[model samples]
Target chain A: MDKFNVGKHISGKFNEELEAVRNKVLAMGGLVEKQLADALSAIENSDVELAERVLSSDYKINQLELEIDEQCTRIIAKRQPTASDLRLVLAIIKTISDLERIGDEAERLAHVAKASFNKDQEHLLVSLENLGQQVLMMLREVLDAFARMDEEAALQVHQMDTNADRQYEALTRQLMTYMMEDSRSIPKIMDVMWSARSLERIGDRCQNISEYIIYFVRGKDVRHISREAMEDTVRGAKS
Target chain B: MDKFNVGKHISGKFNEELEAVRNKVLAMGGLVEKQLADALSAIENSDVELAERVLSSDYKINQLELEIDEQCTRIIAKRQPTASDLRLVLAIIKTISDLERIGDEAERLAHVAKASFNKDQEHLLVSLENLGQQVLMMLREVLDAFARMDEEAALQVHQMDTNADRQYEALTRQLMTYMMEDSRSIPKIMDVMWSARSLERIGDRCQNISEYIIYFVRGKDVRHISREAMEDTVRGAKS
Candidate 1:
């Protein structure tokens, strides 16, 4: 049996509604993942047109978020979900918020891509692309975890974000050095810095989604808990 | 009859519990407001100790958020609140998320305050402080609106945030000029920029809280709606 189906109801309509909401959330997650990927590629390729497309497409993500929210509210109001079912709806709500924020971060990156920069900072761009790819992967896996209600996969996503943070810090230091070496590069470097920050924030948002998944699956509030403690809690629960 | 008590229940205990949760959220809001103010003062006075205090005290805000969340969950589970009651609890949940994020922005500002900078940059500091004050005022008013369930006050806060954004953009342009004029000032100016960004984010977070208040009171999904449309909706509903 699927972990998400742990609390299956005898009422087929209620189950169908829950599944419908879950599918919508997953669809939103897919759009956000593509948006982030496209935004990063736009930055790497300096494709202003593609960047503009990402920005305009952000409205779709926002619309999906609104739809998902309405669905959750309807579920709560009409179905009156309790216990695990309530947690699932709440998790979906929180997940969509994180996903929408990730979309916002992606839009910020697209704005950076849209800005004109004279010189090509190939090294910095490569690092940023790497970071973006990592976050994108985490987002994909976290959504998968959410689909299956897999706490273990969610924990893996959380761990991956820690590495992404370190990469972001290292990249920031390198960018600061570039700014100091040539003042003329300050504007361009600043854009890169902002894009990097957006990517880092996306990583954090991914961790937020992972936490929500864990909360939904294990019925635990892993937020604000130390990583080690959370790992132990996950392990203890699995055992 | 208090605006918040529009749906007053015959169940005295449920009403008392709801009031208690509301008080907790307000108290948490008060703490967050102080945190933002102290962080700004820390920046203005370059008081590292004060900044450190704000950083350390953020845990309390986070704890309050968790407490309020638990209270909301308990209320939902025990009372099975529907319609306006459900909206109220959901609004509280969303508001605390925004408040906690505001606390986070304050912590980031404090970090900037802790960083050592030689020159006063008095003009920029004053602008940043002015932005902070506006956000703080917005925070205070939004909390008042939440307490009273006032859509009108929330709309006022929403409008103030627009001015805050304009101030932030103007300040950013000024900072960019300063950076271009003196290359060596890049590092210090960047700190100020980050602080300004934090302040702007606080304004956004306040707007989110205001939106939640409006949603709770009006029982309308006002999110993602344009300001003009939202205002028209509010007015149309009122008349």
Candidate 2:
């Protein structure tokens, strides 16, 4: 008749299971991050083989995501985790999804690199490279927070997303100008613009992942709220 | 100690609670559909007041999302529902987030409409109206699928997204052609391009929502997969 005793038994096992799921997600995060780096390098050097490798590796990311998701499903089915544990599983499920999409974006960038390198689009290419670096930095910070459970680090990633978005907008404007001044540049510039848009989206996805961390550890929805409000809420809880 | 008896007692209450959450999500879905319609009308008329109203109403969408998410959280915390019930709650939570973002994109379209109209870019206004109509159609279809739980309807939305993207590409190319012909039209065409991008994004968001329906009712992950694959998978499952 004692609910507390029943809770203790389930909670202990649930935490261990959820932690396992978290570790899998972090591992998937590392794979996606490396994939992004490879994608950039592939684009930078016009490494066709490297680009092909990046494309092939996406399947692995997909398979791993499915596995991790199945594991989370099994955990929820077998063990009725609550509060933080439930949030952790849910967050990981969503985070790996974002991570997998990053892989897709990276593959798209590699595709552009394969097709458009010989074209006269050096400036747009440089812009893409810059955008890629910024997104990678944001993604890395969020993963670090997830791995270490560092709320401050996670919040930093969320803030960086705003800056990334601004950069995308500026680059979009710049690309428009390039295409406007030279009709011949339209096709190449469009390629660069789409790639830039993809990187900005990667930044947004990273921000979504950071939100999941806040939700998991702090149990708050920080999606539409301001960064200052999010930081205050998370920090308030920590203190 | 029979656990089935305990589960039965808990699940009986859990079903009622989950139904309430589902009802809330459906209601919110209806509200978002209305917002999307208002946003399109704002874009067509370049009505700043309507834009402001759309932005203001975003708060209500946000509030509804938070309420539904909190209800799901409470159910999750209390009953610790598993399997189908857990999937339903999780899906509802995610769908609400996507719907909230759809509203944000609509608001964005309205804001840009305000800016473009303020600049007196009458040349590009017709295209904005057309793009708004295209996006509104997509939004209507997505909402219909979600309300009806129709997988085929959802699958159609994804296909429609590709067409929207192609139209956006064509719009961008047309804008580039206009800008290149006369630098005087550059500012006005830029506004057109943003509206086109926003409309394209609305279609993308609708695709995202349709995918959520597929994931929730069908228990499949269709995020990175191709549109054809998604539709085929859904069709195959239903058959």
Candidate 3:
């Protein structure tokens, strides 16, 4: 998978600026991936210190987003990129927004980890851990797809998200059953439920990032289209 | 209160296109507002029919988002708008995404309305209704601020969202207590809790839209900045 080239613009300076923006976006993506992974580990181990660190580190992700956004704005204002060049900047802007949001969701999960529960409820943590792993994988794959401009890899992320959604739904049902069996566990279970919700949202955001990748690579608005239709379109493009 | 002008590009066709995109976004905002209102009413009254209408109408919001996004992309490609004009289009593109997500949150609330509960549960409904109304007002004001490019109004929305957040936190605590008192009511209470969460998210999205409005009006990225810092910056700009 060859990374999409951005230095094709006539002006060498413009090309250099665009490449800088791309590199910054990838850096930001790396930070968000680390945030998600650390947050998930904090949840699994109930490591309050690590959870606090994840929460504190969200500022860095937010800072990176603002910096990348400013660069995109500057590129558009200075270079006035058109066609594919314009789309590349636009996609980076949108992707960074999603990445920042994923960081926020990770912060939310970290807060859940920071919460104190009376008993060590390993059972409830299992489903959340599973959902977290699935979303983390989706995030990693989508970022890779974005870096390589691989529409096929992006399409695969869409499929992964559907499985994440199923896992989330199952976890919710399981939590509900837990609450019903022992009312005392309701508060602690609710924390896990919120964390699970955040994980599901991260999956949705990852899918959105993949859609942006597809749109950037193929110049197609696959959004609002049915999954089957989107997959078919991707297949058609491949052929 | 003057709307941000976009026709300065020396191309009348570009101005017309920009106006058309703005109109489409406002139309989409109108639909989203209606969805939120209807979903709230359905939740308050347990009106399944109204809830279903809100659910069905979400497709239109999604479609409008896709249309607005495509138009933004086309405008960038054809006009190569610079500086403020470029920022305007980028802001609209981002605003529509937030609008679409608000519609999603409304759809989730509507589903909660559609789910049959054993009892009226008016007690839990009150806080949700309050949060919903606060978010609704914020959404309306933020859209108006965007349409008029009113920095002051957008700032007011930021304040409104703070109140919405407090309401949401209170509601969640109350619902947790309800679940503890009567384990039998846990499932039904969870529905309201989820709906409240959706409202809280809507408030967050509205806040994001307001941030975009500020960005477009002031050409400053207020996002990720602390509220005090953002306010100080806005004041400095005014002075």
Candidate 4:
């Protein structure tokens, strides 16, 4: 091979290393996403054991986050990647942070579930299931974006997040109405409200990761822009 | 000047730019810090005019955050600083995010305050003031750390946040108890609780920004670690 091809081969090796980092992050995402799903399922079924497992497994997620972080640090120090590679590292750093917090919120939902399990309350569980389903979908979309390096898909995830947030607010208000109508429903309704909140936070963090993806690709901050403005920006760039 | 002096000259220029960024951040911090103080005073004294003014001024804080964020992005793109310089820019970015959220929370608190003004309900306002005082102190400590770049002082801010959180929990419990005892207290207590919640969130965000300071200065991720562990890490590195 020519010298230029040899140089290209070395660059390919660096890309492989970055891809490995991405794989680790996605793996961590998979674990936490399952944690969120299990947390919701446990609440729906009143399974204390599963709830407890979700809470205890948070330490594992935390450890994975630190390990991934250290790995990224070492890679940056060694390769000193430029442009897209640098942005990918930054996205990895920010995504792991949002993922770790998602884990914490999931555990929080599990704690609320375990507490309400004693009362055998299941009134608002279905609404929570719906919210959880939306969060799960959002998480999947973000991971897909990362895997395919698709900024358009990531922007769509942001739009979906706004819908999820609106659902959460409606859920909270509905629960509040229930509690207001009957004081006896206060404890159970509060648990469900908190669960819906946890789900909304997860959706928001997912959107945050999607914004990082756009930043990774375009080197522009799409965070403060409105949904329409951002869509136009992404669409304009693609065209 | 000698060659070594030339190195110092370049370093001095870098330091000046860093100082400019830090100064702008501190100025932003000062404005939000004042907003929090005024928000609390507006709630305590039932000053509708002040509350309206706080709401109106929130747009300015949002503008400041965007401006500072743009400055950091430009600096990173132009200088491509390494080591401490990189850490400084990252810290500024995270701090700006925290500060912007703080502004939003303060605006939320003011809205609740304004609503309470028309309701003629003054009984539930005292506990909110106490919670506000505690959170105000936390904000001050965070700003002190930013101004001084003192890691130890920043650690103290994180620890103080725990106290503010506890205060919030107690306030919520008291309001709940009041509601449980007398449903007449429900509507007003709900608004008061919301204000307390906004302050508590400000405390939590301040703690988050303080952790960023520790990470930036020491190149350590002290997030999942306990407060004691974080303190020990800082002390170990200083020694």
Interface RMSD (Å), every candidate: 1.7, 2.6, 1.3, 3.0
lDDT of 4 by residue, A70-125 (tens): 77766665666655666777678778988998999999898976875334356678
Which has the better DockQ: candidate 1, or candidate 3?
3
Model 4 misplacement above 4 A:
A1-13, A73-78, A117-120, B1-12, B117-120, B184-188, B237-239
Listed per prediction, chain B TM-scores read 0.95, 0.86, 0.96, 0.92
lDDT of 1 by residue, B1-239 (tens): 36556447878899989989999999999999899889989988989999999999999999998889888877887888888888999999899999999999999999988887766565556668778888889989998888788889898998898899999998888877777777777777878888888888888888888888888878888878898988986687667
The numbered model that scores best in DockQ is 3
Docking class of 2: acceptable
Arrange candidates by TM-score, highest first: which order?
A: 3, 1, 4, 2
Clashing pairs in 3: none
Individual DockQ of the candidates?
A: 0.54, 0.40, 0.79, 0.32
Q: Assess the local accuracy of residue A211 in candidate 3 as a C-alpha lDDT between 0 and 100.
A: 90
For residue A47, model 3's alpha carbon misses the true position, in angstroms, by 2.1
Tell me candidate 1's TM-score on chain B. 0.95
- Real contacts retained, model 4: 0.05
Residue A35 accuracy (lDDT) in model 1: 96
Ten-residue region with minimum lDDT total, candidate 3 chain B? B1-10
Docking class of 3: medium
lDDT of 4 at A18: 73
